[model samples]
Target: MKPLNLAQFHLLIIAILLPVFSMARPGLAQIPKEASQIIDDVVVTAEKRKQMLKEVPVSITVIDDLEIQDRNVRDVKDIFNLVPNLSVSSQNQNVTYVGCRGVSPSMINRRNPFVMYVDGVPFSKISGYSADFTNVESVELLRGPQGTLYGKNAMGGVMNITTKAPSNDLEGRVSLDISEYETYLFNANVSGPIKKNTLFFGLWASEYQTRGYMENDHPDQDYYDDRNILNVRGRLRWVPSEQLEINLLSGKEIRQGGDGPMIGDSQIRFHEYKNPDDYVDADSFDNALHARFHAKKFDIVSTTTYRNATEDYDVDYSYGSSSVSHGILDYENTTFSHELRLQSPDDRDGIAWIAGGYFEYDQDKDNEMSMQYLPTAMMNFNRKTDWPCTTTGKTAAVFAQTSIPFFNAFKFTIGARYEIVNKEMNYHRTTTNLDTNTVVSSAAYTIEDDWDSFTPKASLDYRISDNIMTYVSVSQGYLAGGFNNTIDDPDATTYDPQTSTSYEWGAKTSWLNNRLSCNLSIFYMDIKDMQVTEYPSAYVMVASNAGKAHSYGGELEVKFRPVTGLILSTGLGLVQGEYDEYMGYGGEAYAGNKLKNTPEYSINAAIQYRHPSGIYTGLDVQGYGKTYFNESNQDNSVRDPYAVVNLKLGLELSHWDFYVYAKNLFDEEYYTSIFTSSIRNSYMVGSPRTIGANIVFRF
Candidate 1:
């Protein structure tokens, strides 16, 4: 990679500061008291308390119901365009990868770097990483390590979503949207009082369909296949007294989609399409319940959840090439979890605290059947079956955090957590004879492992002035160890957990009489026992622990509303990540190598205009620097830097709303994600320009 020269660096800095300079007027703009009150009414639970966003010491971004409705953000992924330091990529519709603060994990088997919480309940299942967010009231993205309060897998950050609750006022809404590229969406929500003083209920449903973007050029074949999703949700809330509230939520979703064509070895020309029989099918269901009680000095919360899913995956390994052929695979998983928390009052002198205990039990099972067809026979060839694995795991943790005011305009926080985890794996593998259509002898293995960890954190925040503050924090995080079902080695069961300690310093300021807000943070992390996966060949994969790694990054975010009806936001991130030691081909030691998918720099900017005449317009742009797709850092297969643009416009009336939007306005041709293998590498391309319109009626 080439380094930026001094002149270029100065030019970039000037460009970033240009907007702020242009908006600097002679007279200071005064904020309306009513508007300030309205903003303060919004509450956030990220700090374990119902506090205003400006009062919290941590860096957080909030998207409320008004923003959600105005932007037509039907899914969680759609919000990425509006936020800074956030990105989402999907392998298919079923698998999604998210990155925050440049700390995402690249290994397929590793758990998500950021923790996800839905309605005060932590989602424990790894598969829940792809859970769709529907009927959501608000979403909060808390940046930095939240190890003390959030426990494990929070090294990067945390995302918390609050769904709409049952309402006593009768209200409902229905919406229909259609767009180019054969995309359709229908959604409705209804809520009202079931009894005078007994109960309230809410119901929501959504159905979406879209055609695939990639083309399959095989003989007698159509373009890329399509995908469909159906979802329904119901919620009930009971408030028998002023001090107690109970909520019950149930949801189910069914998804069916075709896996897009895989990329071929040749890069210059497009590959041929595969037959319809090579498509993948997926279906899943989810259910959950949550309850909370409020008293004079104490509050308690409990949550329980269950989920089940099944998937049938198929791919054309050859990409219509002569060296490879078609392949098929299947998987199924189930999970259950429960947790409880308690919070104490802040009446004590300069002291406020929260403590919680959490427990989760998960059981997962998978079955894989693969077949390799010969080039000549087309439909007949050799077959191999290595499958039937079950995993059972349990995790228990106790954590607490306390905030104390040391002096005027200064506060300190101290927190700690201890966690215990146990996992057991049972596997049974078998081979089937293709000609005889029978299963061969089976091999079985059982293994178990237990782990324990203690993490601690400390933070100090000082209010320099009424409009500016600075904070510093140090925290520890952990990712539990687990057996890899894909490994054939007997010693693969001995893998260890990955742990890290992070240190951060940041400052937040609201300048120009509240017209502009900017935050800057720098962080460094020391990681130990990093777990990584290695693929020596097309069909072989192994899990191993690397010695150590170091990562450092800086992030800057600016939000400016220069004029009465104009808003502008911009963010930038620069990261440097490297592995100190790695085992390369032939077991040779390789050091000082950059990690895959870790880009050096990224930039995002957006502008919005809202006029009194009921017209709203927006423009958003995002750019990512070049990044390596594989650990080996092959030059030819690396992903090139690219930028994308999106535009939106809307009109709001008393009882009706209309919106028109265009994504990928520039029609950029690029890949959002990639999966590489020895036989053939596959790339998931970004969607082409899509123009859509929506109409909604409120009653």
Candidate 2:
């Protein structure tokens, strides 16, 4: 592999500041020849508590620090192939859309089905998702319902992320990457002690900028949707005694405006328009305090968090027609949450238990939205519309779970959560013809409602043998109810919460003296009052309860270390789901239609090798089966099955690592995002073949 050019080095100085990226040297002395072909142990916090991977009864996909760096996963979207029965993709620079299992968040509703938590604090509002990962210790994906512990919006699953804590010993890493589309990244992280074991501090910074890949109509503007992102975080840790540990963390991310939401009339990704200069800018800030106290009888954990996020957008909505229309949207959210939990002493031989209480307040919406049109040659009149609204939610829940060992080989676990939620919204809308100086339409209303939910979970674990463990579990989960912001009638203002009941059976095993590992899981789910979207008016959508639906699926993950320096892994997923009864968009009877954006199958495989000469090479393949983007299951809008491969080769040396890689090696063309609505279908083109190089320095 060739070294990065001098220009590439200069570009790296422009972006990123980070935590981890330690890979590339495994083929030389990387393993020290003492690894003995034994696979590494994986530990996860799946149950709101830490446990060995094999002992956890849930189907989980854990990405540790090594894999994060090795796989070049800067953020969650890069792990789409690492998890089964999941669709992970990015929206602009701030939003990451994850469709877990068979359930997905509706395009109209702002709430995501799956919930994400960072260092014990949940993002009460999805808008504040951290777009980059810095100094992360691990990321866990728990598939299926988890309401008993996660409370609301976990009807689908959960993402538990842990960031590395400050350490007494000084440690640091800096890396640079240059790729196609004028993409450049710079990441750095440092941690040390201020007073030996008593106090420590850490800081991380990263900047990412991309000129984009999609073509634009303008000759000079090569590609649309350019992006610039900056993230920085700091941590302070206090270890006063053996009984207590506390950490305070604060972070901020800024997304500079590059362009607005891309939408096209057809599935083609190319954008053709008059003014492509407008864009959207977004910012997010977060602060969290986490404390862990070791008591004589139990452990107490407390977390307090506050976050503020804002976004602004200005775009031209002229659908390639002669007329011109423009829209401006400003949005903001403020969230505060506190959680306190007590856990039985870990490493105890007896029963294990956890009980906790949580409270969160979310200001989901906080500004007025407007749409305007200018008088053009083809149109004679000028018009404008404005809607102002404030939406907020308050949620409180108490949860508890216990695991009891019995018969020397069997264990049973049960948990439940009782939650009360309330949402309030006050909105007003007005439309006027500017030239005529007259009001054409106006509406206003205020709505407030409360909901109560009781979710329970139970599971049985059996140790068939020292190498194999099996489990069966049943759980219930639900999403909170809320009102629509851009609605014309108050009668269509609110939508009920959707619920799911899931049953699952799974097995985890190791063979060949820990050289090979395999895990399997099968699940069935019944959904009631499924939330579906309606698009009667352009840019105005509503959420309502559809009738029912059911889904069944299976997943398998395997890893084999056949020889000392070679590793092979594969993941497969199968799913079949359909709406049992429902009225879809436009009040159409769409019962028995397949769920949108869900595929029939998914597959991912990888192979890696390390040579004793400090050389490494790897390849990965990932693909998804047939997928439809609309409720009608139309063939024209289907996402045909496609697969892409990536290759990487690098050399590792003391204090430095060099690597070259190519994504979409064959230059495959695919869609990264697909959205279908009454107005038009918008698509974001996936990355094509791009070659890049990464260089790392550690101290």
Candidate 3:
């Protein structure tokens, strides 16, 4: 593959930044002489404490509810380019992967580099983190190792999602949307107080359906890629007295769709799943209980959660019409978690601190089959496998951070988390071989394993002035090891845990009298015992500890409101990631290859204007550099650089909103995924141009 061209890259950067400069000139000239609008300071809970975003000594991004609506961000993947140095991709609906600063998930079942939390309860299970947003309040993306506050599986970073809480006053909203590709969506929400200052409740629900994007010409194939999703959530809050409060949250999700089919290498155009029957159906339920007790000096909080999910799917696998049925999968998973924390009162002036402990229990049961038929020989072989696994984890940690101020200008903060986690897994696998209707052979085996680890963090901050602050930090991250359940090979049964150390320096500042805000950060991470996935056989995947790897990058974010109701925002991410030393299972040398699914650079620019007369318009553009799809770094397995644009026009009035939107306005052609397996090589194309309109009413 050709190396990145410097001249072309420079030109693209100029093109992206030109609009920002050109648009600002006119806004500046028209600024009102008496304009005195002071932008409000953002509040965040990044360090497990309520503090101003600018005061936190971490690289972070905060997307509020207003931004969520303006950007039409309905899911986690929709915010990929909105933030700097972050990416989320999926091989299929059941196997989503997230990355930040070039550090990505190496194996499907291995612990994620980053962790996501909903309403203060962690959702480490891969299946549980991709739910739709129903009543979201805000989303916070904290960069660098978060091991000090959130333990293992947070090597890359953390995503905290907060949902809207119940209010004392009654309120309700209804929304409907229609789009191209035969799509329809509906949303409803209601909240009110059962007893003033004593009890409250909130409920939300949404339904979405689509005829799908791809066209299937094969007479036997009914559908190729379609979508249907449903989400419902409820929340209850109780305040019996001034010193104590209780919260209960529950949700359910149901989804049915056809997984995107791989476009074969020989095919000139896309759109077909050759298998006779190919589809997926899955459902899940979640519940969380949280309580807080207030005291004069400190506060105590506890949370408990339970979740259950099931998934089943049939795949063409062969990517050709040569086979009627290739594979089928059935799986079930459950998780239970508990956490307790003690936090110092926020009113304290001398010092602040928090301490916590956590525990989780999880289980998985699955059965799969692969079939082959030789019509000429009048023979058929079916290999069916069943695996059941159970895991329990216990974590005890004492974390405390103290801040000491000098001359009321500089702050020195030191924090450390001494964590000990013990995880044990009990697994069993059985396989049977069948021909025609008879079983030829059967085998079964059981295996057990355990793992443990520790992580720590530290940082310092200097308030350069009221509008600017600079900080430096260093931290260690950890991820637990687990047995692989995809295959029966002994070597693939277990892999070692992965770990990393990160160093970061950054600055946050507000300029032009708080009308413009800019943040910059540079980070470097060194990882050891890096876990990498390998496909040794056509249908089998395993994880192993490859050699070391390193990632270094810088991110910049800017937001400006040059005039009242006029906003401009831009973000740029530049990353360089490579394997310091590595080799694949078959002795394939790849010591200097780039990481998979990680773009070298990304750019996002957007502008929006809102008139006092309740009218608004916006334009958004995003660009991504080349992304490799495999460890081999082959030219065929890459997504070349591409850009897409979106437009939004809306009208707002008291208790009502109407909007028209279009995505991929330029109709850019790109690939969402590229798969090159021993059985077949295929690609999943991105969604095409789409237009839609939405209406909402409030009472």
Candidate 4:
């Protein structure tokens, strides 16, 4: 498939949204009104309380169900392109790098700066963050440091997702998607009151399978990266009284797929894996109990959550004309968390305040994080080492925030969180000569560490009329220090603590009776002891501190409805960062290199038109600016800016919805990741163009 040029891309977008305006079918007489004439108001719980999006003094984007449906947002990964400044680099179906602003974790580090919360259950672990968007109500993205309220590892941002609740009316829907590459998806959901207004139940389930994109030429004809997954989510709600409600939520995901990432050379190549153990199997389970009691003046909310995730990976580790393909790297993660909070009523007249306490514990049952397939800074060839380890951690925190109204239209807010963390690890390692059946070295040991931090935030906002608002804020971000996945360094020096202070100013405005809206924000942050990867020797790689560093950026989002049936939307995010002072492993100074895995800019633009005859058409473009895969800023580590286009056409009726989409319409050539390791470079190719159709029936 040939890719479209820059000029054709723009013209295609124009054609998709404009052609429908010339038609006025006879069925127009039955159409009530143009749905796009008025923009809908959004409500969000960004600060742990119900509030209007325009009233919150934070930089946030809320993806409502309408937008999600129109954009074909199948899973969490699809959201990265809808929000400005949010980016993701996927090495495969299981390994992905996610970040926001300019703060991201080292490529090899297990700790992350971004965190996600689903129905009060937190998923902060890098390997435990995959889920399908089933029965979802909304997705809220907080763009900057959220350490003050989100508890842990939210230095960069937070993704707070809420699922739809059961209603009194019996309702259900079923959908099936058929696409290229022999892909098939089946989804179904049902929800209704089990007993009038006292009890309700909701359940959603989906199964997906596909013959992956990577070409395989092995005699076995087994393709690489093929995927098969099943996901099921259920919820039960009980309302004992007008003031008391409780909900129980549970979800499970099971996946059996081909080997991990498709590792290719500087150019593309057909893969041939003869290893018998080359496959990936994974499963995740989540359970949570949430309760709320509302009084005349205050509300009490409590949530208890438990999760278990496990994965077994065995891949043919072949890259750049070499192969070391055998054995297994498996891991299991178990977590438990509890949160209790008290907040003022949403309609209370006095000052609003909230206070909460959170506690969590996690355990890594078994795995080999230290002995991986990475071509470290010191080797032209890869070596096989065996290091299996178990790690355990605990975190406790108390937080409070208040909103005080003054001067008629001005509001002042202040919030803070104090947190304590402790962790321990035990591991055993054995290094053997590749050509000999002899063990060159062996060791065993146990290590423990602890750290504490305080993050605070302050902001003031003023309503400059009924439809316009402006605000200024200052906040701090913190990430507790941890240990490296290496036996060489077992102390706190291996994982330095990171902290940052940021300042921001922003405005939100709506004009012409909601026909147009614009939001903008500018921010600058200063960071200390940034955690990054360091190659100490050609044979050893570990995590270390990169001294003083800073970043500044701006964002703009706009929406306009020129005609009653047409809408146009676009957003842009610009971010830049450089190290102020840093010394590499061998005394090589890296004082001005860009941050790894952080894009310079991100953009999302879309246009949509719905005719009176039930015809719906949409065109969207998602793009990212030049990005570096590593901190070196070398030629082999960077990729130029590129954009991908998607098209959607659908029909809507009282009980049916139908659509066909072409994703990556031009079959654009792009790689999700490009890194220079050892003597050559390896690439993780992105998805190719896909053409598919969906059918839905609602009752």
RMSD of each: 9.9, 4.1, 9.3, 6.9
Identify the runs in model 4 with alpha carbons over 4 angstroms from their true place.
1-34, 268-277, 320-322, 325-327, 368-384, 433-437, 491-493, 536-539
Off by over 4 Å in 1: 1-42, 70-72, 106-110, 121-128, 265-272, 321-327, 345-349, 369-381, 437-442
> Between which residue pairs do clashes occur in model 3?
none
Residue-by-residue lDDT tens digits, candidate 4, 117-186: 9998888776757767757889999988888889658888888899888978666666677788767677
- Worst lDDT 10-window in candidate 2: 26-35
For residues 549-584, what per-residue lDDT tens digits would candidate 3 score against the true structure? Answer: 889999999989889888888999888888888888
lDDT of each: 0.69, 0.79, 0.74, 0.79
**What does the lDDT read for residue 47 in candidate 3?**
83
lDDT: which is higher, 1 or 2? 2
TM-score of 4: 0.91
lDDT of 1 at 66: 63
Which wins on TM-score, candidate 1 or candidate 3? Answer: 3
Model 2 misplaced regions, further than 4 Å: 1-36, 89-91, 124-128, 260-271, 319-323, 373-380
